[model samples]
Target: MGNTMLYVITSLSVGGAQKALLNLASSDFSRDYPPVVIALVEVDGVQKQFAEAGIPVHVLGINRLTQLPWVLPRLFGLVRKIKPQVIHGWMHHGNLFATLTWWLAGCRPVLLWGMHHTPEKATLERKQHALVLKVGRWLSRFPQQIVYVSRRSMQRHAELGYAMQHAQVIANGIPLGNNREQAAHYASVRQELGIPANARLIGSLTRYVPEKDIPNLLNAIRLYQEGGEDAHFLLAGEGMNAHNPALQPLLSALPDAIKVHLLGVRTDAQRLIAALDIATLSSQREAFPLFLAEAMAAGVPCVATDVGDIAEFVADTGTIVPVADAAALANALSGLLNQAPKVRESLGEQARQRVAARYSLNAVIQAYQQMLGKVATYSVSNA
Candidate 1:
């Protein structure tokens, strides 16, 4: 009914966590022991990526609290029939759901939980979500190993009383084998957007959310223009559109001199990233931003706020500024904008080299393989 390894994630979307899991699913490590992907909900477009990769995909389609009872029985039945050897959870909700299914199935498969996001205070704002974390922290001990994509996430969870005895840090591995698109590739996007070839193309692949701080980036774009430089910005991701309240007021205030193109939830992220002169993020929080690593891997110079693992990850290859400091972001963007083409190319090459050295996909797969021994001492039933 399903593959040996079961991967449970909150939802199927075109996000970093999903991409990382997809990469793992497509790897040689998975060829020997394939995984059945389970998403609580399905978003359009990305489910096709999983199907194309030859993995079995199952969506519970649980959109609301009322749907939980109806959907969970199907999940439970699937678990009972498949008898997955390993249950790997992605994010908090997924981990809890995996644990639930593991219990109901009466199968003691190896349980591995993945922690991908920062433990910001804002997360505990919801009573229900707050309850989930409390339950997760208490139930955290049952998993064979808890994998944190960033050390900060791991340390933060440990502080929150997660079982640190079996916890380990494994950064999201970037597939470094992708061929960098040539200038012609970016020229196509620039042509479609009506942005001039000479205009500095600064782009960010992020949603219009409080954490992403798109408003801050808009302010920086304004200040950069006020200082006598003209540039075009391409923003893409879920909710990164004209209708988003978090973005509208800021977007309305920016001068006409600065061009901002909102491409909502693009599948061709690599092509878009490659076409840019600079890649940026003014996010308030992050563990390790795979987009920055991907941009760097493509030899694109980056300007990001110093958050989470960014300062350490970018090192000397890219510029890191203080969060919420529009002027500082403006100055950094301007610094890169003013650089000669050759100098920028050299900097971009250096950025690519940094990512190649540390964040390769193979290294991550090996780390996962080491931790993923045979189904723990558990495996009460394979039937």
Candidate 2:
């Protein structure tokens, strides 16, 4: 018999939601509460992450989940066969599929839906959002509890009018590895990227998507340099090739003194974080990004846009600027950079302390376990 099973958005690549779910399903929490994972569609690489952690994964080869009304009965068949104690889903697509599958299976398997971002910030074309929003609100009724990566995310859902009394905010946790190779890793990366040894490094780790607003980051860096702040910018992540052709133009417009290293999608994000003098997040919207938490855990001070739960997360440890305002972002970066080294160092230290106290993987997983137990008990009692 399988354990509490989770159906996810995709298992192919790593995202914040994927990383958090994998951490939980493969965590030591399994020793106290058994678990299993089901990927809704064919996904690669993730099986390896799970297998390495001794967690089992099952993938349904559904080509397009957007046509879930047609695809759900088949998924319901799979759930009926597995008979897990609970069915948890991730992202909007995964939540819809899992909730429908649970209802169709004729079993209330302690449905839990994970919302990783504010819906208003989704990449979906605006024309399609109405249908997606309607479906999301309808399906939300079936879940015993809805899990959000940040309070801001939950609030967005409520603002969108998806009222559920069981809504909860459970931020994502990150397990930053030991800083064994911290200095060496940064030195090597910086050298390879051709960044100047003495130049101030201001960096960000984010996928090059429009919502991430890489253009604003480029403009912010320009402002930083224009104000006589000698700096280099490093953007580490892959670009959505077809959509993000703006990157090349931004790079071409820069002077040689301001280096912009595009370290395309890396598993070594922590190493990249360690390589920087300062880090940033200039997204138009977000839900407590992994980059911010990872940078904090790696003891890097950040200046980010006041989006999602960032203001709540940063508190006084880092600077918060308004979204998409390059001038404001540049000013904040300049101020943080110009501070005394000890002052910056102290801020970074406090940032690390905050992450350790509230955002450790072990602590977040324990919270999920308690929530899962409540979900299970409520489902059983109501059954």
| Top candidate by lDDT | 1
**What does candidate 1's lDDT look like per residue over 133-205, in tens digits?**
8999999988888899888788778777888988888888887635535566678888889987777799999
Cand. 2 Cα-lDDT: 0.78
- TM-score of each candidate? 0.94, 0.89
Clashing pairs in model 2, backbone N/Cα/C closer than 3 A: 237-265, 238-265
Query: What C-alpha lDDT do the candidate models reach, one value each?
Result: 0.84, 0.78
Candidate 1 accuracy as TM-score: 0.94
Assess the local accuracy of residue 35 in candidate 1 as a C-alpha lDDT between 0 and 100. Answer: 82
lDDT of 2 at 200: 77
Which residue segments of model 1 deviate by more than 4 Å? Answer: 1-3, 177-180, 374-383
For candidate 2, the TM-score is 0.89
Task: Give lDDT: candidate 1, residue 47.
Answer: 91
Residue 70 CA displacement from its true place in model 1, Å: 1.9
Off by over 4 Å in 2: 41-47, 61-77, 104-107, 121-125, 196-199, 240-244
Per-residue lDDT value at 278 in model 2: 87
